[model samples]
Target chain A: MIRLHLPQPLSAGAALVPSLDQSRYLTQVMRLKLGDAVLVFNGQDGEWRCVLSDILKKGVVLKAEAQVRPQTIGPDVHLLMAVVKKSAMEFAVEKATELGVRHIRPMLTARTQGHHLRLDRLDAIAIESAEQTGRMDLPVIDDPAKLADVLEGWDPGRRLMFCDETGGAPVVKALSALEDSGRPWAILIGPEGGFSPQERERLRALPFTTAVSLGPRVLRADTAAVAALTLWQAAVGDWER
Target chain B: MIRLHLPQPLSAGAALVPSLDQSRYLTQVMRLKLGDAVLVFNGQDGEWRCVLSDILKKGVVLKAEAQVRPQTIGPDVHLLMAVVKKSAMEFAVEKATELGVRHIRPMLTARTQGHHLRLDRLDAIAIESAEQTGRMDLPVIDDPAKLADVLEGWDPGRRLMFCDETGGAPVVKALSALEDSGRPWAILIGPEGGFSPQERERLRALPFTTAVSLGPRVLRADTAAVAALTLWQAAVGDWER
Candidate 1:
């Protein structure tokens, strides 16, 4: 069951109060009434089983029964993709979150040819994805920034696995070199038009960047982002651990 | 540049003869005349560079210059996803093809809901994806079959890494264990409603089945299919090799 957003803190030993917005969804949308059960989870606390107590004009009330599972951190893997079309970008973010990305950085590259991103709409999609996927914590969605700036300010500690559209070293070579090293890493993917010659050169020259190929095929930006992340996680992230 | 379908083989010193359809695309749509360069590739032969010779109503002619890279097979991986909605299913297939899946098997489960499938359209998507990705071979698309039939006639040599929605062992565990043998493998992912209890039980009983979890999240059927395939390829296929 999906968790509803409640206004106030869920008291451990007190009555459970679902927000008015959620109350309407529960009563009107879901047709769930008093005495009906629902799963509740605050991003702060563990998931809970709540029973409806009173359906008030303002909202509805419930009493917490027990905790299902506590909120835990997912992988340290982050995905940084050059902003593509709105639909593809949204799909990439949702899939990245589901694949256990802790941070999503939508970078703007020289070749990026997309419109303004609706941050609120993107956030809602992420939230709904998290709720549906049973993810306790939603990924941190960072503001979009220029690729050059993001690279210039990059820390040396985090390994940057750049998904080279030109098809460089086999992904296995890059991934195997990082195995057994407990290091935080991120995957970089290009937009639809792909990286310009200068941008590609700059990325390839970065000391922290490790260029990798996603096989022989040219994947769309969204697909590349997800595939690169999946490869990273399986090769070196918590999947191997 | 996306590879264009040209007549004749793509071998060195071979004369190209574009059919009427390709001639129209080159003359009318692309507005390319004589002496314009284009990239062409045959599934068996490597990609090639050719210069347009003549633009005739009957056909277009071109002469091959030099051979590109030799044809190389993609990652030795296959995907089996329960049939989903039309768009979602198409998205999954396109992404899978871009991610270098060698084969795609669509299945129908007991709890499967959606039914509309446009096989021809999906095939076109795969062809376009391959042409865009510079793939020398197209991934085989299989017709939808009953889940029980797929399992009962399972090959003993091939391992089936089933994505269990109920949360079994993390994907990494099963992948690591399988990596040692380096055997051929396929990933089985269920639909939105997931497998029925009996379906799950029968799957668990299969000697070739290894249930793996796609983390703690409940990803959609399409996302789960891609994630499972990526993880499998990384753990035991070309990524590790």
Candidate 2:
């Protein structure tokens, strides 16, 4: 059965009540009919087994049969990347969601470009990726914020593993030093031009930031995002278990 | 200074010889005249500091002044990914080179599309990546070969870690159990549709292979390639040192 993220609260024996948009998708795209089984999950309520109860001209309705799995949170990992070009940024966002990132913060740096992000399209990408990857939750995508503003209000307990383009400590060393603390963490990757001198200085001065090297080579922003996340996942995330 | 690969052996006080293509690049594209300093490196010889000695219509010559760094190989990690679509495959090859992968083997699987890959273009990408990333060594891109053939004639000393999409043993567990005896290793990533059932069974029967899961999500082949390599580097490569 195809999985769909329904907006309404889902409980045992409750009607599915898909929105008009979702109903079109179920009827037209998936060609689902009455009595067809579909897995439905609301971010707040747990996942539920649902059956199409009625198909009307305006919309389709589903009846929740039973609760399949309880709502659960993903690992406390966030992917923070400077807004890259349109195609690359979308690719990074899709991969980050698949890799279990719970939040994606698009950073606006001195050299960052802003007019490319389509918030609605990106949100759809996240939902589709989560559904395909068997993720029960979707990553929250925040509006792009200036780099200085992001660091100014940084959480002290959360460590930001900055992928320093100039190269610094190796990722393994940085991860080992921070893994025991259990701090909610974020990985920051710069844009194509990289951080300006002032931005670099401010980030370096922040107490919660640690500069780390992915390798000797200079990876593209998108590649850096995935590589940094992979390193973090291997070193400190649930992969260890 | 822009670094370019001149795979010929460099000797102390030897005259820098630019090829016909390189001569055009220096004189036309870069607009460099006599006495301009450019960096050059060969895979076998170390990086060299060269000053343009003469500029002619047909050719250009430079004096190799000094050695910047000795030739050294990166971590002996190879990336073997099943060939994907043209653009995605090229992107993987470029990123793999940038991330310090020493060898790239494009595996031809049963379900692989027989799209002709341009070897010359991939080689150029590797060279350009090495030049931009400050890596003295360029990764070697091998001709595409069958996965079963590559695994059948594999070296016994080198370990092969396959990214099993079915999520079996956690990757960290498989990586930790790998004995880092300083032997060359490779990471194998499957195609988008994943390996066929028979192919998976055959892979599992291999004694030198390790099946690892990249968390719960179904990652694209490109993302899985980077994730698997990062895990390997952290667990057993120079990062551990």
Candidate 3:
């Protein structure tokens, strides 16, 4: 069954009109006719089974039949990635959603090249990823912010996993050393040029930061994001469950 | 200092010429002058420092200076990935190299879409990644083969990590149960639609296979490849060193 993400509240027997793009996808592209079944989920609501109730000039209307799955969010981890090239940045967002990140923040550091971000475009990608991955909720893509500002406004309660390109403790060992406190966590990945010397020094001096090395090889910014998230989930998050 | 992967042998006082693409990159793109320093590495030889000795109409020549870093190979692991779409296939190759895979074999599974494999293009991506990642060796991209045939001639001595998308033991626990056999290993990732039910049955019944699950989410082939490689490295490979 095809899955679609909707923003409206969902309930049994509710008539919901999909957005323009999604309507075309169901009617023209997928050629789904009236009475065809589809799965729809809003971030707030659980996944629900729906059927095409009407095909009109505006769009296709779906009638919710029953609730299929209750809403369930994954780990409480967040990712703060420095702006990279367009493709790499987009790829990181999609993979982060699939890997169960709750929020993604585009950060700026001293060495990070300034790049314009299209938040709407990233939100669409996240929605599509959530739908495809059977995720009940979407990962929020926060507004781009400078690293200093992000750290300054940081909630000290949330532990941050800093993926330092420079040498640090092994991830498994470092993560294993800290018993799971079930605290909200975040991961920070630097740009391709990496964090400047001053930024690295400050990050290392931070109290809530846990600096760890991914491996010996120099990984791209996007690769580092996925790797760090995987390690965090495996070590202390919900992978074992 | 810029680095390039060259096929020729490297030694002090040996004059070597770069290929046309590399020559353009060095001269036109990077705008290098005579005596510009570059680091070159061949799979067999350790990394060497070289300087542009001459600039000719055809290309620029470099004379090897001295050895910088001794050659060291990462884990003896291989990746046998099902052929995905063009962009995803290329992305997998690049990520596999960056993750320190020793070799990559593109396989045709039951559900795999029959996409033409461009060995040359993938090789170029792998080379560029190796150069960027400071890898001493280049991971060989093998000719495309059928999964059944590849398994028929399988070497039982090497363990196979089958990333079963249809649920298996958690990767951390499964990989940990085996006490670092230090034996050769390979990872098998299925295509987008996942392995056929028959294929899954056959894989799960294999004796030397260790079936593992990445997480609850539906991971794309490329994401699974990176996640599996990272977990294997952290668990048994040389991430600590």
- Per-candidate chain B TM: 0.89, 0.93, 0.98
Docking class of 2: acceptable
Q: Pick the lDDT winner.
A: 3
lDDT of 1 by residue, A133-212 (tens): 77777778888999889888888889899988677776755776656357888888988878999998998888878888
Candidate 3 deviant stretches above 4 angstroms = none
Off by over 4 Å in 2: A1-72, A85-88, A109-128, A165-169, A177-182, A192-206, B12-35, B51-64, B110-116, B177-181
Over A69-144, each residue of candidate 3 has an lDDT whose tens digit, in order, gives 9988887999999999888999999999999999999998898887888999999999988888788899999989
Docking class of 1: acceptable
Question: Candidate 1, clashing residue pairs?
Answer: A133-B218, A218-B133
The 10-residue segment of model 1 chain A with minimum total lDDT is A5-14
Task: State TM-scores per candidate.
Answer: 0.81, 0.80, 0.97
Number of the top-ranking candidate, with DockQ as the measure: 3
Question: DockQ-based ranking, best first?
Answer: 3, 2, 1
Per-residue lDDT for B241 in model 1?
45
Model 1: native contacts recovered, as a fraction: 0.54
Q: What's the candidate order when arranged by decreasing TM-score?
A: 3, 1, 2
Considering only N, C-alpha and C atoms within 3 Å, which residue pairs clash in candidate 2?
Answer: A16-A62
Fraction of true contacts kept, per model?
A: 0.54, 0.61, 0.64
lDDT of 2 by residue, A1-241 (tens): 7889877878767876777888998999999988999998777777788999999888998999987888876679899889998877888888898788989999999989765788898999988878776677889999989888888788898888888887768776678666553559999999988899888888888888888877655678988898888878767887666
